[model samples]
Target: MSPVSPLLELDGAVQADGLDAGVAAHYGNPMIEQRRLLAGEAVVDLSNRGVLGVAGPDRLTWLNSISSQELRSLAPGQSAETLLLDPNGRIEYAMDVIDDGVETWLILEAGELPGLHTWLDKMRFTLRVQVVDHSLAYAVIGTMAVDPAAVHLAPAAPNGVALTWRDPWSSVGNGGFQYADAPAHPAADWHWTEALVLRDRLPALRDAVRAGTVSAAGTLALEALRIAAWRPRRATEVDEKTLPHELDWLRSAVHLNKGCYRGQETVAKVHNLGHPPRRLVLLHLDGSDAVLPVHGDEVEATKQLADGETERRGVGVITSSARHHELGPIALAVIKRTVPADITLHVQSQGISVAAAQEVIVPQSAGSVAEIPRLPRLGIRTPGH
Candidate 1:
């Protein structure tokens, strides 16, 4: 047998539906659920996420040598993330990494499992590392804060406590930097967290929800909070050409000073000398209720050329969008860095157009770590000549 499919297993009161093979979109009302979640009073079943186990003495060191983060010193239960990149620095996979003293657990999107696992296996070679898919045996749960009510629902963390990856998206983590310049970045209020749970414990968790003894939220609530906080998700934010800079993900995901791994050269070059070609923006979508742009929707804007004729052109594309319980409709889009900051954007979803206001995340002046003085051209005038 392949494995027992996990879809539609917890639908009694929660009405768990297919967000993925083994996850629910919403328990009941996503708005109420989101409120309960932000208040640290709810849990979200994340069983559909892929969990991979790495064991052996060389696990952390081996992983550090291959991916984007500096993970050799990762302590048990400490959370971190790393990206696997192609030779040209395009993102290939993103790993949400946590370690117990004896093993390392990598959490990732479900659809990425086969590729990630196969690559991990091929890379082992003579190393003492072993990789296994533990998705069938484990699940992931998320909440907004670190409270016992949330903690106890999941299996003990890799360090012999409840296993939780406290999201570092709220601030600049070690060896990383932030380019976004809002005086009070809304992410300052972000406290979202995820934990690993044993698959066996899910039934009890669902039972508690059914009995009204515990509150549970869903992915809808999770996504709304994520966009509002300007956080990045691999499933939505990354494309074949995505670099950390475009999404402002360097705040937590990339370790600038970490020794070379795949893609480090490009990361260093772009971040230090060149501006990323595109920038991420948060859009406060118009409340016309005509349309809500989904992922991949084109963001259009009208621009006037020197001739004074207007052209409606695509300046960006929506990656993720949601209707927040409080914020109404909102989205995160990646726009050309050259797109004028002052112009209003329109999201084209079918025939309806929703007006959007850009809230810049990555500023236009987002590069040049160290200035290199320009050398005077040969035979050209120098200063004071």
Candidate 2:
């Protein structure tokens, strides 16, 4: 667990639970906070998020050789996201990366730092790269405002360039692919950014909130907006079987044409010839009951049978759900790729069944973009023979 954030001491602050336990969930009015957050007048206390720094001259090149992004040419102050995958191509870590000439900063979930730090250290070998945990020294502040100055925070600029990481989810990154066929992707408007500030600055930021110079939102408001935007978070959307293609993560965090990395073969094969077994979707849940399905809640759908009967079948599980201030109750779920896009699903939440409508993110035909032609086997015998 991370050290409790000092912002929790603010009046009307309610600490969040689960993954965001150490931070404030809301400062009394989540709906108003969400409005402030969307209007670029609020900042979120993300002290629970982890920060890692990679120093030395070889940081960029070394990182490019091991992760899924093309980071060799990452200019100073440019923001990018990368993924570390296992041998089988399952996601192990998702990092928001930014270089500041002196060091490469990696912002990720607090729980992921220790393991990612250990693995990075072992990979250094003879390279001129050194990884250091900066989570305790620097805390993350999240805001929808693209400019850090809008939030009244001067982002750290140890190397003369600010350390804010602008999310690339707003558009398909170079060498990346988009599986969502929406004419207007929700992510196109996502201007989420994270700014690193010295941990000591928290008190001053809290004071600013008290003085009304700035407003403060919480992780819940951010999560609600993230869900509405169809953003896939590493901590919630990822499972042992998750593929970048499933959540349409290839749109931002992956470079499909990049050189070999740990799971490049599987990544290529899946994109070229196979489909991810599952796909991610945004669920518009029925809000009449006022019940919200928690994570891991079963999602089922009713199917009409040939015998004129109806049957309910399990189709997926809700990974993340929230009560959006505008969108009502919304959720992101991972469902079977074969599930019909027009189907009305049911979320079993707190003993009541809530109806959900699916908005396709990763379609059933998400992969096999290459459409490579199959050839006949040379050793096959002719039917007459």
lDDT of 2: 0.92
> Each candidate: what lDDT?
0.83, 0.92
RMSD of each: 2.7, 2.3
Clashing pairs in 1: 157-161, 157-162, 157-163
> Considering summed lDDT, which 10 consecutive residues are worst modelled in model 2?
146-155
Q: In model 2, where do residues sit more than 4 Å from their true spots?
A: 305-307, 374-385
Q: TM-score for each prediction? A: 0.93, 0.96
The residue-by-residue lDDT of candidate 2 on 211-252, one tens digit each, is 898899998899999999999999999988898989999999
lDDT of 2 at 37: 93
- What is model 1's C-alpha RMSD? 2.7
Compared to the true structure, candidate 1 yields what TM-score?
A: 0.93
